[model samples]
Target: MKLTILGSQSPYNTTGHNCPGFFIQDNQTRLMLDCGSGSHSLLNYPNDLQNLSIILTHLHRDHYNDIYNLQYSSFVFHNQKRIEKPINIFLPSTPAKIYEDILSEQNSFAKYQIIDENSSFKIGNMNISFCPTDHPVETYSIKVQNGNRTIVYTSDSSFSAKNRLVEFAKGADLLICESSLLKEHGFPEINSHLTSEQAGIIAKEAGVKGLILNHFWPEEPVQKYVDEAKKVFQNVIPAIEGLTINIPSIEKELDERS
Candidate 1:
């Protein structure tokens, strides 16, 4: 399995940095975890569109705005006979107006699938599940597993004792968590976002192998987030655009032992 960071900037995009978007691929499947603004420019367009599936954590513009770009691209590809199938899109069915607007177009070239915390699905070799997050919107944190390796992505969310994030991320090989605020910026838990320290605490409690802090404010230094998270969890890094992390599959080892 390989995880690629397409964008990590939050709220809005900046020079060279886009909003939250990630691309994960394992074996035959190619999944776009989110399609935030400016992320479409990073994709391979018609080429990558083949066998592509996308999941939006919520209806926030920063998390899903580029979906329109993708929808347009899909339509063009289908018209040109460059692709035969519509892309599969998984998203929450809330904020009724936004959901209705997204699906209102009859000519759209994407297959929509409504998902919630109770949803679990498989795409190729990867199994995926979701857990509700502490965001104002109907957001969800995603978990994906393949060949005993697990990855959890915590979308925009706040920290709370009642949050199911730690349990959802428990024992994950990689925890891609949002570090949207700095501790000095005031109490983050009271807001709808997590601080760098909060992200670290979650990583420590979850016992994850590594933590990648993302969804940063454009003005802050990425190093700060990394440094703060390291205070709690040593094995932590800041998410960088275009960075690709390769997760080796353990299936071969199991096959050899068998």
Candidate 2:
């Protein structure tokens, strides 16, 4: 499978990047994870808009605002036959207003699938599962598996209840974590986000093969986040816009050598 960082900025876009967004693709599936601010503009044609499946971890504006733009483009572009069908969106079912709003536009641009704390589903060659994270609203951390290779994304969560978080991400091939702040900045008031240190701790405890740190605060230096995470986990990759990573398959590697 391949992972693409469409955007990595935190609450909003910075000088060089957009807000949180990701594009993942394997042989048979293409999925978009989180459509935050500036994602729509970054997600232009021929590169990311064909037969896409979307997963919105929560309805927070920074994680979902670009969905409106996606909906609009889907309608306009499909009318011109640029796309064959409506996009599929798997999203949380709480915060009734957000769920309802998405459902209201289902027939037009998207097909909605309700995701909860314990929801599991399949798409193409991937097996996906959800775990409720420590966030104010109904938020979920997602795990995607294709055979033995697995990727976990910690959308937006606090450091308070990390046991479940660690277990959910255990043994993942890559952990796409949200490090919203530096350690010295202190935690968010609502305890809804993690600092770089906390993100690295989860990655280390979970024993993931690699860590891709993202969802950064715009004002801070990106290297600072990477440096903090590297202190705990050696294989740390900073999430940069348009950066693509291909997961190495052990079986494939063996076959090639033989």
Candidate 3:
């Protein structure tokens, strides 16, 4: 499995990098996770847009802003490529206004699929499950499992004392968590954002093999975030645009063992 960071900045990018968007692919399947600001412009392969599945964690502007661009781009690409199949999009329903506009339009660009209440779905070889997050709006933390590799992405969530989010990410090979708050600043839990320390705690409790901290404030020192997270979880990385990560497959491990 491969994970590419298309954008990692938060709310709005202070840096040149786009907002929170990711491109994840395995051998046969390609999935776009969160089409945020500048994602359409930052797309490395316009042809890949022809056939892809997109999952939007919530309707937050920073998270879904690029959908409009994608719609236009896909439509144009479809005309050029004669692509008849619409892209599959999975998103929450409660921000009814957003989905209404997306689904109301008669376009061949996207097919909207509603994800709610313990929804589990399959796209090619990947099995996806959702857990309700502690965000202000309806948000979901996604878990994807393929073979022995598991990835848990906490789209946007606040600190929870109960540790339900930790349980959701249990045993993941990679935990892609949002670290929107600085430990020095002391964020409000009600705001639905995680501090670097909180992110580390979750990664540690979840027992993930690797931790990628993203959705961060662009102006802050990257090393500060890493240092804070490392206090709890050792294998931590700060996400930057164009960063590519590869998850080793179970077959490789078995081959080495033999």
Candidate 4:
């Protein structure tokens, strides 16, 4: 599998760091986990984004800023190539209306189909499942599996239930989670984020092969976050844009990489 982080910041980017964007691909599937700020430019407007067809996960401007851009661009791309297949979109029920607004979608947007909890779906080479996450907004976490290989993505949310994460992450070759805090830093108002320390606990307990933390504050040195996660997970890693990680199974990727 190939995991590429297109963006890895929290707030909308104005400087260098772009918000959150990730791409995952296996033998038969290519999925864009989240499309935050600058994603449209990253994909190159009017360019062939043909490698991607499946999209899933949370709702935050930093997570979906380019929805309209993708829609408009896809329309152009499809017409140029005489493409026929509609883009398959996997979305959380919580953000359907918001997504519609963002895309200015009439007739449920163009070239895309939204999948919710009420929907059971499949993409190439894998089966996917969504879980509710602890967050200020209604959010969804996801697990994708193919044979014994597994990958879990925690878009942006609190890790209040380590067991739940472990369930999704168990035996996963990779666990892409958010480490948005340092335990002592924030109060309860923070609601839906994890400190580096808590990030460690989840990775360790879940026994994931590798723990890659994203959606972090840029102010902290990468080493600090890595060190923090290492306390619980020996294979913990701080996320960086353009980083690529490949693990065999979501469960054991850390064991080999660390």
Candidate number with greatest lDDT: 1
Over 18-67, each residue of candidate 4 has an lDDT whose tens digit, in order, gives: 77777777764567777888754555343235545545466778888766
Q: Could you tell which candidate, 2 or 3, scores higher by lDDT?
A: 2
Off by over 4 Å in 1: 161-163, 249-258
CA RMSD of all predictions = 4.5, 3.9, 3.8, 3.2
Candidate 1 lDDT: 0.86
Residue range 5-96, candidate 2, lDDT tens digits: 88898788866688888888887578988998887675657435676889999989889988888887787778788788778888887889
Q: Assess each prediction's global lDDT (C-alpha) against the native.
A: 0.86, 0.82, 0.80, 0.68
TM-score leader:
1
- Rank order (by TM-score, best first): 1, 3, 2, 4
Better structure of 1 and 3 per TM-score? 1
Per-residue lDDT tens digits for candidate 3, residues 1-258, read 787888888778654688888888877577888988876565655656755889999999899988887777677778787556777888898788988887776654778889985799888889999888887899988898988889888989878632888989999988889988876886665467888888999989898888888887777887888889889887888877886777775334323321
Order the candidates by lDDT, highest first.
Answer: 1, 2, 3, 4
Clashing residue pairs found in predicted model 3: none
* Candidate 4 global CA lDDT score: 0.68
